[model samples]
Target: MASITPWRQLLLDSIQANKHLRHSEYFQLATVKENGRPANRTVVFRGFIQGTEKLQFTTDARSQKIEEIKTQAFGEICWYFTDSREQFRIGGFLNVIGNAETNPLRLKIREQAWFQSSLDSRLQFAGPSPGIPCVKNGPDDNTTPKLDPAEGPVENFCLVTLEPQEVDYLNLRKMKRYSFVKTGDFSWTQRELIP
Candidate 1:
């Protein structure tokens, strides 16, 4: 299906392309740590929320990124497609969803995700929190954690969403680029940029 707008199409492209990608999400996420330093990591692309201004990804609630997001809601996603020699950088406000206080839209997605995720995936979040050191490394241990005895949705599952305030798309093959800045709610002012 063709997208209604170029901006939507670009984002949709990223979401659709993520499926064939394994080594990366066809993008990278940059979040600011509480210490005012930049931290970049790879995240799987979930999808854009319908009739809204957000992109989604799943993460362990215990991940350090959660703390960073709680401190600062600002973040960016950089998407590059080698096949098309194109790059799309999206800067926006980020929010972590999947709790009692989270809105229903995100809650619904998280609910579906919980059901689809494998037992092994759920077990990951049930273990020690991310960045906490342990005597034995997970891979070296030659054993994986078992699912919690209760056998329910992992308590740590969360959906991370970004609401874009700016989108910059560049096409190296054509030597051109454009920038779109949010002008108002669900609206943006676009401009061609010097590539």
Candidate 2:
């Protein structure tokens, strides 16, 4: 089993302390577009990959972020826990696991995410291409098709993983802050920072 880093432990603690708030499960992901512009969006945090430090999230394959990620795989996630007045900026590289994935483990991970998603969540992947104009009653109709929760992911559904390289954690209430950078496979160097 891969050992958990100190920052990961802190993040887990923060998640437990603020589990009651729905927003605590959300974080802002920033990526650089092909045109050299930055794009940001809110993404729900899926649980970490088993026996790994990678963080997981789901996204539509047709979303603009996919192209952005292709242009630049490096990105950062900024997560804030309101109840705890804590924030974490995690910088890392992202991996998109889609229908074309051939690795057995990655395919299994994608399948697990699909099965774990709610029916309504899975239905979104069946809808029209995302980021396109929505029509009242045309092909863009927002009606969701029935999807079996146990079924595997659709073509448009992708499991994205973030491999953290650096983390900056801040606690507002205590006026304390720390920065951590990955030093080895399971080791990190932490430094105190002025909040």
Candidate 3:
């Protein structure tokens, strides 16, 4: 089994400490656009992959972020925990497990992510294509209808996994910070940073 990094432990602790807040699970994901500009949006953290440090998230394939990720596989996630007064900026590579994914493990994870999502969340994948101009009284203008859970993941539903390479952790209350860089498969080198 692979060892867990200290930064991962810190992040998990922060999550636990701030679990009461609904937004604690949300993070800002930033990706490089085709024109060299940065694109960012709030995404919910699904959880870490079992036995791995990778972070999991769900996305619609029709979202522009998918194209941005395909163009530049790297992304950075900025997560802030309110109650804990801490933040973590995680830099990593994004892996998309789409409808065409063939890896059994990845496919299983993707399906599980879909099934675990709320019905409203699952229906979003079946709605109109994201990022397109909304038409009056169109699908984009209203909440998506409920979907059957047993139908499984829609074609547009994707499981996004981020394999963290570097992480910057900051504790506002303590006025301290640290930078961690991956040194091996399951190890990292941590350095204290001036807050």
**Local accuracy of candidate 1 as per-residue lDDT tens digits, 106-185:** 67777766666667767777676777777575564665567754454567888788988899999898998899898876
Error of 1 at 7 (Å): 1.6
Clash number by candidate, in order? 0, 0, 0
Model 2 poorest ten-residue lDDT run: 139-148
For model 3, give the 10-residue run with minimal summed lDDT.
Answer: 138-147
TM-scores, one per candidate: 0.82, 0.96, 0.94
TM-score-based ranking, best first? Answer: 2, 3, 1
| Tens-digit per-residue lDDT, 78-170, candidate 3 | 998988899999999999999999989889999999988998899888888877877998655767556777898989999999999999999
- TM-score-best of 2 and 3: 2
Off by over 4 Å in 1: 1-3, 14-20, 100-105, 137-143, 148-152
Model 2 lDDT per residue over 96-154, tens place: 99999999989999999988888888888987787887677776365667776656789
lDDT, residue 47, candidate 3: 96
Point out where model 2 deviates above 4 Å. Answer: 139-143
Which parts of model 3 have CA positions greater than 4 angstroms off?
Answer: 137-146
- List pairs with backbone clashes in candidate 2: none
